[model samples]
Target: LHLPAPTDPLLRALHDILRTDPADNRSLDDHGRRIGASARTLSRRLRDDLGLTYPQWRTQIRLHHALILLADGTPVTTVAHHCGWSSASTFIDVFRRTFGHTPGTRPTT
Candidate 1:
């Protein structure tokens, strides 16, 4: 999750938009339109600049925010909702797959 800052202007703008709302589930085309680029251009730039496709980057962003909220004692269901997961169970599955443990098992500081 430690992505370096994107040097490309478009990527930086896209990152700002994505960070503004992890729950923003707009299609790539829609996002592209918002930023005045074609989806293909955006996709290529994301891959080149960040080594992540749009979905991958978005998932990472969501998971990062989820960790912060969880550390603050947010409930699983609420965190799932805020992070744009379909449900708490889905979030738990993804979290377990990524971290090898349920969110509740995290050794919070």
Candidate 2:
């Protein structure tokens, strides 16, 4: 989750919003209104600054939070809900796809 600081003010604002609630599943249009930008502008800014679409960036945010919650020994189902996945199975699928292993199987520090 070592993200580069966004140079654009709007992108920074968006990042702050997402960081505050990685579980937020708002549409780009909704988020744009919150940050005082159009969806297109926000999307372009994200691409320019982070080389990611809104969905991609949000997924990273969710995954970062998921890792932290898992490290704290939260149950997978609760973590999935806390991170905005529709269900534990969906979260597990995404987690497995992203990290090549399920969250429950992550090595301890």
What TM-score does candidate 1 reach? 0.91
lDDT of 1 at 56: 87
Candidate 2 C-alpha lDDT tens digits along 21-105: 8888999999899889999999999899989888888888899989999999999999999999999999999999988888889
Give the lDDT of residue 49 in candidate 2: 90
Candidate 1: residue 5 lDDT (0-100): 64
Q: List the residue pairs that clash in candidate 2.
A: none
lDDT agreement of model 2 with the native: 0.89
Taking all chains together, each candidate's TM-score versus the true structure is 0.91, 0.92
Which stretches of model 1 miss by more than 4 angstroms? 107-109
